[model samples]
Target: MSDVVLGVDIGTSSSKGVLVDPAGKVLASETREHHVDRPHPGWVEMDGGIWWEEFAAISRALVHDGDNVTAVGVSGMGPCVLLTDDGGEPLRPAILYGVDTRATAEIAELTRRFGGDEAILDRCGSALSTQAVGPKLAWVDGHEPDAMAKARRLFMPSSWLVYRLTGSYVLDHHSASQCTPLYDTDARQWYEPWAGDIAPHLDLPPLVWPTDIAGNVTAEAADETGLPEGIPVIAGTIDAWSEAVSVDAQNPGDLMLMYGTTMFLVHTVEQRVSTANLWGTNGAFEGTRSLAGGMATSGGITGWLKELFGSADYPELLLEAGQSGPGAQGLLMLPYFAGERTPIADPDARGVVAGLTLSHGRGDIYRAALEATALGVRHNIESMEAAGGSIERIVAVGGGTQGDLWTQIVSDITGREQLVPSKTIGASYGAAYLAGRAADASCAADAPTGSSVPYAASGPGVDIATWNPPSHTVTPNPGLRQDYDELYDLYRQLYPNTQAVQHTLARRQHRLSNATDTRSTA
Candidate 1:
């Protein structure tokens, strides 16, 4: 039997699993679609139980009889707060990353307690915001007493899967660094004082590099999922970092743009580059650092617009949007339907569509949505450079890269060519690569007795370039430089100009939602 590694990633809307041979050939891929539970505005969550269930089902589906699954790799959306009781059962639905804006009050409280945003940023690499795991822990302590009382373990989606598959409570350093005040980026260890302050009762998991062997599949888990018992499991990381690894974009000056439910930008840096708005953290492997940013929406806005357009599918809309041309027929939209993150961490920032006229059709609106995300990407890229990071190459991944329209607009708007890899199965594919590395017998043989080997060891000798090289490039349309420059300027000004009104309307939305809930109970 040929040795095959399994990779799975838990995402916002679905779980995807892929099987890959050591030669980088994808044998099979499986997807399980699921939805996040949004019980209240600004709150996004999911039952941790769903993660394990989806992972197990995907594993079973991918691993048939006679398949020699050598190793397992996992990744997921993160910096999430999934607390469990001492016995390892989840206490409540996990509080998701930056999109869940319910932690505003807790963010403010923790910032004050920790001296201020700058102090925390200097030490933690990222400040308190909806993205930080510390504030969410504080939120739980205040709001859900029952869950808090029993909360004794912390797990992100990837870490939770590791625990389920191997009975090892471990989190990747990349994910742990995003935990903000709970971890010190320079020390590469938990900041006990801050962690104790925020999560007094919770016992944090030990950290490992994403490639390190966490543990082998336990007999119990293998029995339930049919994976071979004792196969190694790599300590995987947050999905974006894995996505970076998948395309070999972790080199310094390489920037990865992920277009999915939310837009994510990750830039590899030689050393730590902390920005008040962007996340600065360790990379999946050691000796590399990353400055990361995310927009609350991207394909999300496009998908929502598609549902509104009713009969038109993405292909038809793209054709019409292409005809709408460079300016979106005088329409411009802020891609903050779920609220904005990075460069401007405004949870109350609402999406704004300017220059909308009665004559504007769905195509024009769709074009504006695409342009808005492109502009947002440009905004984050500028912020990254401003923070002392450099970008030499831009790589585009995720489902949005399937069409040239969106990637073209982004390049024309940003004036940077984007390299699209041959296989954009994304984080799952990257996870499999790491798993293949872990499964290399020489990796274990090369390690010192009772000590782990560094990820840079050439024993595995795996190179991602051979697996998913850049198959094509989207070059910028220099003809649109002047037009996009003017548009980008207007985009930068729109948020500040409408800040007051946006906050007022956002508050009114909260009030109306509260009233609706009250009436339902009445």
Candidate 2:
């Protein structure tokens, strides 16, 4: 009977679970695919119940082998707003992170109320934007009062799992920091005045480090998941941070590039840093900070393309994309299908494909999409460096990293090397490591007699270097740099040139939707 830790992650398109031994070898893994609901444009949501259901399913499957499960770790896509009643029942489907731009008006109102963007950034380490939980909370309060009235607690995917597993209403410091205006980066606590103003009726969870032991799983949770009672559960953070941990990218000067439904970049910095273009917040572990940026779409664009192409798998598309080469056969695309996020933050922004021709095929279009995301990565890297982040190392993670073509395109476009780790199971693996650290006897013994123990001891903990190391590096091809530079310049120009038309079209779309709703009601 080998001791194992179970890590589960609630992702945008799926829930993943991994079972790992203390030595970091994966014993079992499971994934349950799911999709978010888009009832209205810019509105992305998932039923909170789905998270728990998937978690239980994944857990049962993973634990079926009778591996002695020692601890439980959890992570999820976030800074989401899952408003729950006092008893922890969800009031509405959880509003997802950045991709859901339904709170644009609420963002503007909060920014104005809080003395503008700069002040909010200075105080909260982030400006009011789609990524901020406060705006989403305010949006609910304004638009759905019935749901708001029932909401008395806030839960992100990670926190929701923690609450269900341990019966502890706790949020990790990293996740809490993203609840901009409500969390003070300097004070490292919930800013009461701002929190009261924004979410007046709800009780914010107690803050804890992602590694801290949230609580032990009770008998009820054990029965549902086939896990032993009293297994320690960690206060896991967002999926991106967990992915960073999985790749050993938590150190200063390490930038993690996550390629998923949305592309995300997290640059760990030594001290607190703020940027109007990017998000600055507390890191997963204590005494660390991160500057983060996310593009609204990346793999999402490719997924759309796959569906549009009809019955073509990714390998077939990748082969075609490879043949299309450096400039995607003169096509340029803006990877803003879901609207841009970091460095742009334009919710009204729409996708644009330039240089289309009758000669172009599906391969060329797919190649253009890959190049578009690569260019977006370069844009974020430049912005990050401008904001005092030093990106000495680049680590790539997530589903998009599985293919070589995309990674090579990114490396060539950015003129940087990316280290792809061996175990790209991502956040679930990181959660398991965190749980293993929490279950370490040394971590428990070092704490003060009655004080809550830190999830990690005051040293190099959970040796990620050995657990997951770089399998290979993607190096840029020097010959393509000049051509990419020229195309990059064109890519930069295309957005501003078409901004007005895109805005008008977006407004028209809203108008048409509203008219249809009115007609249906009549």
Candidate 3:
């Protein structure tokens, strides 16, 4: 049997695992779907136990009793805050990434305390937004003192898996960078003063590169997962960075566009580019930097539309959407159902469907939803470019990339061609590659030092370009560009045009929801 590596990723809506050989052929794959828990508005969370449970299940289902799986790799949806006790019991449900907007007050308080948005951005490479882990930590300290008292350690999904599997507490530098104010992007270490202020009692893990060998799976973990007793495990980064690795879009000017429950954009830059509009942080590998932008909703709007339409499936919707043509037949949507993240970090922002008419059909609405996501992508790209991001190429990945209509709309709106890779297996595949690279290096006695890549089949090391290359390019239609440009202008204006109304309704929604919950309890 060929040596293989098992890669598992704990995602937002599911956990996915893939077994791959040294040559990157996927041997087996498994998925277990799950969802986040929202007990209150602006609060999205998941039981931390679910992450480990899913990982163990996926491992057992993928690796056989006697399979020669040389290594294990892990990735997850993060910069999450999972506060655990000394013995590793979760104190509370893991506060998820940016979508969980419960930290708004904490964000403002910290921003003011840290000398302002520019100061924090200059030091931490990201502003104190919902995305920054520091604000979330402060929120916990202020709100959940009972949990905070018992919180002896902190862990994200990947780090949590690494701790469970190898008994080694470590977090990748890339993921650490996302813990803004808690980590110094230049120093690549925990920023002591701010970390002390935010999570004083928590024992932070050692920082390692995503490709570094975290440790070997212990005998206890082996018993649970049915893998080799001492197989190596590579430290993994966040899902988006791993997705970038999967497509070999880590070089400067390479912008990775991830479309899923949420839309994420990672633009790798040559030098550090800090901006309040976008997230600036260290890359997956050393000496690399990225300006990242995330939307709280993308496919989320389309999914909601599908559920509302009830009769039409994705394929049918895609067909009708394509037929509806550019500009969505005089329909426009804001795709801010969950609130906006990058560029405009407003949690009160609500979804807006403009240009609605009795004449418009479901197909036109669906097409408008698709176009809304595309326009958001354009907005993020524009923000990135304005902040000194050189986006020369866009590589599209994720579940949204499975269908062509979405990508086509994005290209048509942005007037930029997008390259889709052969194997868009995403974060899990990237984790597997890192696992393979680590296993190869461990096997070789003469591996070189320095860069993450070593023992490459060609070039310097295990490059993703060798494993997966662009299968096709989605080119923009020149004719649609003029129409899209007009709509894009309106899309940008619609938010500020109706910001006060959105916020007013958002506040009323909170009051109504609270009353409903109180009555339900009574």
Candidate 4:
């Protein structure tokens, strides 16, 4: 049987698994789709059980023929606050990535109790925000005491899956750094200094390098995944980090721009650079760091607009958007349907569409949505560069990259050439690469004691087959750039100017909708 490596990615909408050889070649891949349940307007939750079921299905599908699988690596949406009981059963659906802002009060309280923003950033490299796990944990403890009390351990999305497979509770340093007020990045260990007062009696998991071996897969997990028992299970990381690895983004100045349900941008940093606007953390690769920024809505905003406008699927919509020229022909949109992250940590931010005229058509509106998203990407890239992180190269990944118009718009907006991976499976391929490395190491170690072992290693950098510059680089037109620059200034001003009014209106709308549903049910 040929040696195989399995990579599993647990994302917001679905879980995908891939099988690959040692040379970074993908053999087969499978994806299982699921929905995110939004009980409250701002609250987002997904059943952890569903993730595991999908994972099992994907694993079985990939390893059905009993290939010689040596190792496995997992990655998923990050900084999640997953509450599991003593026996490792999820008490409630896991709270998703930093995009979910139900913990706004917790963030403010943390800042108040801890000296201030600087103090937290000094310790964790990231200021208090609703995105960090510490704040979310505080929210659970305060609001869901029953679930909190039953919680024996907390894991990020990836950590939860590893614990399920190998019964080891651990998280990578990159992911753990996001647990502000709890983890000490300098020490590379959990800081119990505030763990007690923050959440009394809460036990933090051990932090490890993303590639460190957590444990061997248990017999039960092996049976489900169709792999041999006792295979080493590597401690994985957040999806963004894994995507970076997949594209050989190991060095500083290499940026990983992911376009999934949302857009996530992370760039490696040589030193810890603090930015009051962006997020900074230790890198997935040992001894490095990262500056991260994200937008609340990217592909999600596009999808919502698709349904609202009654447009065809994404491909067809892209075709129509191509008909519209630059500037969206006098239509400007703010892609903040969910909220805004990165530059403005305003959860109250809402979407806006200005410059709409009777002359505008559906194509113009569609073009505006794409341009709005691309402009948001540009905003983040500039913020990252200003904060001491360079972006010499950017590797784009995700379903959104399929839209040439979207990619061109992002390049023209940011004025940086974008590289798209030949194999679009960013995170899954990265997970497989990590696994293949482990397999090689295992083979080397078993060969001899104290003697050098011979075994081929995984590919050094990103497979070029998965990456190439676009045929035509979209150079920023001076006229369009100047116009968008002025419009973007206005776009940034909209959030603070309208935050209060937007929040009030959102609350009233929420109440009214609830009352109407209650009346109808009665």
Query: Which residue segments of model 4 deviate by more than 4 Å?
Result: 442-479, 510-522
What are the per-residue Cα lDDT tens digits for candidate 3 across 1-522? 667889999999899999987778888999999989988888899999999999999999998865788778899998899999999989999999999998888888888988998888888899888888998888888988999989988899999999999898889998999998899888889989999988888888888888777778889999998888877887788999998888888889999999888999999998999999889988888788999999998877888789999988999988988899888889889988888899899988999999899988989999998899999999999999999989999999999999788999899999999999999988999898888777675443123222244323343235678788789999999988888999999998999999999999999988988998999999
lDDT per residue for candidate 1 within 141-223, as digits (tens), equals 99988899899999998999999998999888899999989999999999999999888888899888898888888899998
How much does candidate 4 score in TM-score? Answer: 0.92
The collision pairs in model 4 are 421-466, 422-466, 422-467
lDDT of 4: 0.78
Q: Stretches of candidate 2 above 4 Å error?
A: 444-461
Two-way lDDT contest, 1 vs 3, winner: 1
* 1 or 4, greater by TM-score: 1
Residue 156 miss distance in model 2 (angstroms): 0.5
Backbone collisions counted per model: 0, 0, 0, 3
CA lDDT of every candidate: 0.90, 0.90, 0.88, 0.78
Of 3 and 4, which scores higher on lDDT?
3
Candidate numbers, best TM-score first, in rank order: 1, 2, 3, 4
Compute each candidate's TM-score over C-alphas: 0.97, 0.97, 0.96, 0.92
Better of 2 and 3 by lDDT: 2
* Stretches of candidate 1 exceeding 4 Å from the true structure: 444-453, 459-461
